[model samples]
Structure formats: C-alpha cells, structure tokens
Target: MKAHPFLLHKWQHWLALGFGSGLAPKAPGTFGTLAALPLVWLLALISPLWAGVAIVAAALLGVYLCEVVSRDIGAEDHGAIVFDEIVGFAITLWAVPFNLQNVLLAFVLFRLLDILKPWPIRWFDRNLHGGLGVMMDDIVAGVLACLLLHSVWLPLQL
Candidate 1:
C-alpha cells in the first residue's frame, strides 16, 4: 500500500490523523479509537448531552476532513484517516458512566462491531461512498456498541 503523504501542518489532516494517533504504521484505526478514550472520559465528566454534541460535531466535520484526506491520499477511507474511528468511539461511550470497566467494554465492543460490520453496518460500509460512507458505518457500529453496553451490563449492575 502506498503511504499517504500527510502534511503535519494542516488542521484537517491533523484531525483526520486523530491528532497523531492515526499516524501509526499499523492498525491506525485502533490507535485512533484508543486515543479517543481520554477525551470521552473527560466528556463523561460533563453532561452526556455535551458529549453527544461533541461527537455529532466530530461526525459532521469528519465528512469534510475525511473527504479531503481520501482525495489527497488517492484512496477511499485510507488507514491513516481515522477521524471516524475517534468519533465512533466517542459515540460508543455516550451516556455511559465514566468507569474503567465500561470504557474497556466500549472499546472492545465498538472495535468489534466496527471491524465486523454486521447487517446494516456492513450494508452502509459497502454501499455508502465519500465522506458520509466513511462515517456512517462507524456511526452505526458506535450505536450498536452503546446499546450492547447499556442492555447487557446495565441490568447486571442494577
């Protein structure tokens, strides 16, 4: 695979690279998602609504950033472009309490659902193109991960 020529100075590229976490030579998506954990935890300190807003903003801005980066890189959803993963992780943790266990679970579940892309997630990933396509599949995965965490473990804790 040809390496993307990521200009370090550009803000959009910086975001597309997940603030440098997405620059990892391998598994950039995983690193991007991992980097989102702290921000999610910090946002968890605020209202969940605020976190939701932030995630929404990320998704919305990600469209332009992803599109620009993909075009620059000459590939669609290139591994180095990981803003979607970062935003997806944030969406996965929305409304969930700030706890180590929940964070870890969200990480695992989000990554799995994202990588596996079952059902609509898979459909969206395959059918969608450009920025919306890059972000939508991960959005679906994030929602499913959030739902799984809430449904499977909320009852256990209560």
Candidate 2:
C-alpha cells in the first residue's frame, strides 16, 4: 500500500522522520545517523562513558518505539522508521573522538555492519520478530563497531 502524507498519519509521519531522519533519502540511514549528531555531541560533552550508557538505553528504548511505529504503519521494520539506525550510530560513536574523520569512519563501519548483519545480527533479524528484533540486531552491530573502533585506535595510539 502507498504511504499516506506525513502530516495526516501520526505513526507514518514519525516513521518518515526516523521518528525524524525518515525525511532524507539516498542514504536515509546515514541521514538518520547524521540527524543524531546533536544528541551525540551533547552526550559527548558529558562523557564517553555516559554516551555509552546512553547508547544502550536508546537501543532498548528504540525497540519499543520502533514496534509501535511499525504496527501503526502496517509494516515491520519500515525503512522510514530509522530510529534504530540513530541509536546504533550513536552507540558506534560512543567513546570515539568528535572528529570529522572518526565520525565518517564510524558512519561507514556502522552501516556496513548493520547492512551486512554478520552471524548474530543475521540470526536476530531472521529469528526474532517485532521492534525488539529490529533494534536488537542494530545494537549488536553498534557494539561490534565500538570494538572495531577501539582496535583501530589502539594501533594508532602507539
């Protein structure tokens, strides 16, 4: 079925928005993540540890929100509802420096892992259902990205 106009449909509207990032195309997930920059910045300002904690919290929260939005839209894991991407990307950036290069790297890495959906991610996507399933896989990817970033950083530190 065709998606209704954003204004008339509450869930559809929010879904289109990524709850807000759904507005961008060509790379809605990337844009959805970029849309989370401000929150990422604010969290970074507080502390990396805090940002990490927040990422976990956001992922958990996203599961519920995504589920609700999906049901409203008569879909499952609609591309428009990209809050999962936002939370995942935020998790990726956690503990990383706020530099353009790092941001780009994290973005690429997060998207790769998210899209590739290696082992556990693929497992979750196929086996689990509903919002929790949708968000859980991305959260796992985010954690993987976090580990990769640390590994990349460790060598550079020397």
Measured by lDDT, the strongest candidate is 1
| Steric clashes per prediction | 0, 5
For each of the candidates, the C-alpha root-mean-square deviation to the true structure, in angstroms, is 1.7, 2.6
Tens-digit per-residue lDDT, 37-122, candidate 1 = 87888888888878788789889999989888888767898877888998888888888887888989999999999888899899
Prediction 2 global C-alpha lDDT: 0.76
Candidate 2 at residue 34, lDDT?
A: 78
TM-score of each: 0.93, 0.86
Candidate 2 lDDT score at position 149: 85
